[model samples]
Target chain A: MIKKRFILNFPPDSGDKPFSYHLVKDYDIRINILKAEVYPGKRGSLLLELQGKKDNIEKGVEYLNKQNIICESLDKRIHFKEEKCIDCGNCTAVCFAGSLTMNRDSWKLEFDKEKCVVCELCIPACPLHLFEIDFR
Target chain B: MQKTKTYEEINLKLKSGKAVILTAEEVAKMALECSPEDILEKVDVVTTATFGAMCSSGAIINFGHASPPIRMEKIRLNGVPCYEGLAAVDSYIGATACDPDNPSYGGAHVIQDLLEGKDVLLEAWGKGTDCYPRKHIRTKINISTINEFTLFNPRNAYQNYNVAVNSTKKMIHTYMGTLLPNLRNATYSTSGELSPLLNDPGFRTIGLGTRIFLGGTQGFVVWPGTQFNTSKPKNEYGIPVSNSATIAVMGNLKEMSPEYLQAAYYDKYGVSLFVGIGIPIPILDVEMARRVSVNNSQIETSVLDYGTEGTPKLGQVTYSELQSGTIKIGGQKIRTAPVSSLSKARKIAGELKKWLQNGDFEITKPVQMFPKNTSLKSLKETEADND
Candidate 1:
């Protein structure tokens, strides 16, 4: 269950290539498109979530690289200051993705990074000065 | 009138033995285990609490006159204008007041800066008169240097509030925080069943001079809150669905902590303070205990259309429904979120409960019961002189 977010860049002159189709048929990988702004003979950008075996995921990335597509991993990251978080469950509401949630048993906030879209909705939702977003 | 226990008897029970105390969150389970009469007889006190986005919250400071004694008129703390309507050195920095120079860092942040023990730039101007010499002053002042500091809030607790959402196609920012267009999200602010006023719906035990837990320290209720409206629709529980009675509270600023008091900012919604408050309700009788046992499913609030100027009710919902993480509106199950923090409120209630059991806290007798027949009046309907 190797999963990662990617920012794929397509050059304006990169010929008509079914970039996503090739990855699935050739490398046996799964691609979930988060966002895309691409067209024929136009520079394209795609935000994608890829899931597959570790070696197959690597092979898929190499395939995209040879196609003149810059496949950069988008580590859209957020950190919770454990001491500051009140665990009031405000984040769980604004978060469209279930990445941020409350553990019903402990009532403690459980943040699943795998499901986060980096929407930054939790930043303002928190009453306490917790949930800091750092994107590099 | 219904039978009720006096505040003295409960205090005696607390002092003589381990008082059967329960946090606001624990009341539901406690009720299921024992009858209301049985629980009421044994339970000395039920602690109610809330931590929410209270925009009208802030502190009043009286800075003893500086050398030459300038009669300060206009005042700004960290570029945020504070109300200097009181005599010379007195002013109030409200939570919603924004910084004139820098829009982002507002009065709420200034209050936070002071709580963090940081020196804030104090700038003021005045016209020198016969009694006062200096005209203007600019200096750094921290919480310690101030002569008197009081957290005087006109409306500390709102009995019930609306859950906000934007139904319009365009996004809108409001004091309720950013409301996404087309009902992408809904944000509600209230401690629900754990709120002090909710536990005592009819204002039975809450009134003037009632000792409370303010920012982890003991404080008092000064008077009925501004916009205290007793005239509103109520349910079987006697809890008003509309914005009902409010309370005016005062606490020592120096004795407060940053943990309970904080500054907050919404992307485009503006600044406000997170004030932690807890009030203890003595189970005077079975009736009082029944009131404290009010559940979230029984208490209700409205989801409002924030895209409009004045609040308009779009739908009616309960705290249980809101806390369930989803709410249905316009044939869609939209995600529901709370602007208030129940976790923080529970913490405050638990802390007060400990203070009560340890004999560190004392419950004060209400000087007077809150008014019941008052109607909310507008400013235009009043005059300073006796009409």
Candidate 2:
């Protein structure tokens, strides 16, 4: 009845095979492996639903840890500042979900939170230090 | 060196459940003509390093059409040459016939050999590998974000994700197998007979604990792709493609440590390695059960009956109740219902977790049910009513 969740942040270019298969076999835990969905030109997200007993789940965690699948906590504070934004469309160009769009009249920017899976792709796209990740 | 029988003979033996060991050359030749099933039936164990290829996502079933039969290649296990083509089949046989003297190689080769057939053992194993290898790659410096853009290339995407997963699995398996046993033998506290000491539940608990710690530390490698790209060469097969970024979510490890796991392992094995060893491998065979479950659940037609007035009401009831996260199962109020395909899948996942923790560890009837018939029946009934 006990349930726990952890996010595993991968470096750019890592595959899902070794982690997925090992989770199933080594820890004896079945995971709902969500397909890695990539926004048009942004980083992707791989969602996994893992469930087991308190101890087994812990064992599964240990197993993942030993394999180097570290837990990731998102910092929502990292965001783009409005005034410093250039509205050059660079962030929009790299945005996979069109989460950032250009305003019609002025060269201004707009942000959509619903479309974001928190991949943090647009943070660095802005040339100016307009974005920051809020770890809290 | 002696005059050997034709590849056909070896293929025949593989198909008939007869165990025959062959060298690498013989396996390659036989693989050209043998079916995956043929290879599986005849080989109990296969050892080869070429296994990396078979486990890859790009691997295909040649069936004699492409260069050679992909299933016929041999895979190595613990420095021994083994056939991977028959891995799934052999795993089933091995699980059923495995003795304490020979623990299921966690059905590693068999799971790969049987392809989907390996699911038979996997479902029974209750998820996860018995052993996992851990590694640490110190980076030159911590680079938060490596690239500014994402690559739309499918090949790069697939490679990136696949390699990460594969590397993680390999590391876990290696560490569990290599380090735990050595650690236990070296740190054992008993002063009695060494052979009997090996069977003590206390020792096994310690071993499982060590494996858990190793597994927990192993999780660190799943994240921080920027380090991997900058530190490792782009041409390396192990590295993920440069263009893709991975968002890895790791599970909490507070409960999965060695001390807790020691208790679980002890509960299952008792204090005697001999008794644990005596436990029947076949009936507890994870591979065979997974196969039977998947095969029986393959797509099929079905029919359902509902009274003329009750049909629509049934749909409304299911929809409403399922949305509310409750169901009337055999008059008892169940907390969840399988209203949609996705929900059904989620439900099954829940049940699988339950089975792992509470059900007998030995292979038993599948606790989850495939929705093939239920969906088909409902669809047909709805169509008839519409017509």
Off by over 4 Å in 2: A1-63, A74-90, A98-124, A127-136, B1-387
Q: Candidate 1, which segments miss by more than 4 Å at Cα?
A: A7-26, A36-46, A58-76, A79-83, A88-91, A102-108, A123-136, B1-4, B378-387
Please list the C-alpha lDDT of all candidates, in the order they appear. Answer: 0.81, 0.26
The candidates score, on chain A by TM-score, as follows 0.65, 0.41
TM-score of each: 0.88, 0.16
lDDT tens per residue, model 2, A1-136: 4534345544444444387676667666667643344443333345445666667667777766665455332223335676544233435534545556544323246776434444554554443336664321
Best TM-score among the predictions, by candidate number: 1
Candidate 1 A-chain TM? 0.65
Fnat scores for every prediction: 0.48, 0.00
